[model samples]
Target chain A: MFVIYCPYCEEHREEEEFHASGQAHLARPLDPDNCTDKEWGDFLYFRKNPRGLHQELWQHTAGCRKFFNITRDTVSYKILETYKVGESPKVNLEDASHG
Target chain B: MDTVNVSNQYATNSVTERAEFGDSNTPVIASALEHANMKSLAVKTATGLGVTLVELPVTGMLVLRARDDKPALAAALKSSLQLDLPNVLASNVVVDNGKSYCARWIAPDEWLLSCPLQDAFEIEQNIRTAAGASSIAIVNVSGGFTTIMLSGNNANDVLKKSVTYDVHPSHFTVGKVVNTVFSKAQVTMRCLDTNHYEFIVRRSFADYVWLWLQVASAEYGISIEIE
Candidate 1:
């Protein structure tokens, strides 16, 4: 069980209160009508299954009921940093591996 | 402390409006625990015990939610009820303003406020008036949930077995509230004082929570105080 720190609630809560909403920071095409079929398919179905480090979108389902991002190590399950939505992650694959 | 009885505020309001929900004074409302029929079970459990369990006589409970503009509504609630929104989890609660109405933090943007049953409607209207066009939601959930108090020497032990959250005195204290998993269910817990903990569970989960507590506390003791 992982303990996640909610940036908004400012506390480390049990992971049971949270839900992983999939990859974070994925930008949508500016003009969806002009996008090729492949581009739309990629946006809808494509996601990174990283090995060492991963950035994930998580929602605190039980506690604060807010969405945030988590920079975690997939292999070790160590959370490097948790930031709110629209905010940047302090740790990513580059510096996250060392962390 | 959240001062001012939230119900009393409704009594003096000059709005002169009928309750949106039925007038609570004569409504035949039944709590979720009504399915469990705890009254007789409580009588049988209280024979000779150390710790005591009581279904607290709570009148009305409102789930208050606020979004982007939280402080505006919080300030309105504070002025109308004299209770500031608890800024942190498990450290501050506007419980027992010495007038029966109490409030607890459920989430950063959500709070559970309980007051007299007869005045829930008028109070809801009063809060809406106080909020004045702010984006907020006040939901009356009195029949949908209930409060239970567990007190005595082994109360903490029973809690430890039932909830995943740490119940150690060092971590949990008076006026602190937490939303955590209780076995397979969810509950909002508050520490009222030493060896005394309060639980706010949905009516649908009330029987499950009660049964879980019954089995967990059976090893130590079971005492029930029906309100």
Candidate 2:
């Protein structure tokens, strides 16, 4: 049984306490009102699902009630980083060694 | 023409200021939960500041919402209480010095500040002066919340069980403040000192958090600090 660290609670709790939110650091367009329908649709729905390393956002809805970024390998299930709600994720997959 | 002593049967239970009503009494009251293994762990600052670990009985908490754009409100708060309002994930300290204080912040045009059982009036006046007519509201949450102070060698361990925020030394250093969840309930956590932390929670959920503390501290053998 593995546990995930909750950035808000400061503890590594059972994975059940957290829900994985994919991809952090999304910025809303400055002028969403003037965007085309396709642009808005792509912004809202597109995601990068890589097989190796992935940068994702996770919300501790059952725990901290805050959002954090997690850099982990999908195959190995190894978490690289967990950052705060407003901060940026500091993971670079190219520099990291994946198992 | 001033000779009327009206009998107030209704006034007995209707104390307008909840803090003053409970002021004469003590603030920290022990709980009466029956369990075969009623274990507790209380910790305090290494420096031995009155920073203690306690599970407060029935208390009230309110989440104050206000617009930081209002200059009058900010000025009023500083002048009356000497409290610097916190913005976003930040928090401020309110005290004559470091001895006593009530840290507050701006949570998206709103602020959450807590004080002793009876300091609501002064807090109200100060807020009114600072937040002059700029779409601000103050709701008395005296009957809604409670407080718990966690201190000691393993208080952080207990907190780690319920909160998802990083409480590591690098992330949650002394004087850090966070509004997070404790178990299933939401709580505002403030690090008062190196080994001490304070949590503000709803009255209805106090029991749940307490039970959580008990279970979380099973390995640490929590020491209850009774007043």
Candidate 3:
């Protein structure tokens, strides 16, 4: 089985140790009180479920009780990296294309 | 080496006196960070009572603390422990070398590195240099704690006595590690395999925990391993 790194416990555990939280890097609006209904709706519900190399958030509910990110290929189920919640992951398509 | 034998007569007492190590006046032997018999600390259980229990001896454990500012220290940890330090929660990294394994990044500023009891100091030294100039802390806690590998039939029943977390297989399967309060003590619990788990607790609390475990497993019978 694949191992995902937990930002809270700070270790890479088996995938079984984690629960997938759809979509990573989702942010709240700067001013929720001023935002439109559509902005709030998009912020709350929209996500990218691409065929390859998708980034998502996950939780280790049983282990350290923290959240982190996982970059995986949905089609192949191959995970590229698991990083901390606040930090950005290393796998960017833009960077990969340049290299 | 001294085991306080609780007669069947005193089994009714909630707080029974266990044959103690260290000072006699102390309520319980705080094996927390103390070496018990050169092997890890453990509690022995009587058989034929349907009591299910497991004991782990001086398994080595280390605690590493660092911050995001300490890039060098983090790198050193990566090279030394060979596991990535996730800045978030519920994750762990494992690297093995024959007899021992190192599990790193169990917390934001802390990491737990476990090995054979004797290798504790050496492992500490290797990581110490990597932590220079960083506001980091690495403490040798092998003395304060010992481990119990609990699994097999009725393992969950034993855990239920101490932990408030849900240990149901559907929630806590293999490879998950949790730090939770166990009765009056706090422990770092890791699910090893489907039927096995590893509980690391302070040594001073071993006797108390051991006693509580007996009460918890009054039905399944316990097996003791004396090395």
Instruction: Write one digit per residue (lDDT tens) for candidate 2, span B1-227.
Output: 22222232213434533665563433332343323123333332123322235665433233565554546556666776687766545667755644344645424455666665445545665566556555556665655666777887777777776676668767787776666656677777788777688787766777787778767765666556543
Clashes of 2: 25
Location of the lowest summed lDDT over 10 successive residues in candidate 1 chain B:
B1-10
- Among all windows of 10 consecutive residues in model 2 chain B, the one with the lowest summed lDDT is B1-10
Every model's TM-score: 0.86, 0.57, 0.53
* Segments in model 1 whose C-alpha atoms lie over 4 Å from true places: A95-99, B1-24, B90-98
> Fraction of true contacts kept, per model?
0.74, 0.11, 0.41
Q: Residue B189 error for model 1, in Å?
A: 0.8
Task: Tell me, by lDDT, which candidate is best.
Answer: 1
What's the lDDT for candidate 2?
0.62
Clashes in candidate 3: how many?
A: 35
Per-residue CA lDDT of model 3 for B1-227, tens digit only, reads 22222122212334244443332322232334233342332345444443334555566677777666557666776777675554432335464766555564465566687777656666666666665555666676666787766655777777866676667787776667677557766677777766577777777777677667656766677655453
Q: Model 3, A1-99: lDDT tens per residue?
A: 666666555545555556788988888999999999999999998888787778888987556657888888887888888887778788995564356
Q: What is the TM-score of chain B alone in each candidate?
A: 0.81, 0.72, 0.69
When sorted by DockQ, best at the front, the candidate numbers are: 1, 3, 2
lDDT-superior candidate, 1 or 2: 1
- Model 2 misplaced regions, further than 4 Å: A1-99, B1-13, B16-53, B57-62, B68-70, B97-99
Residue pairs in clash, model 1: B90-B176, B90-B177
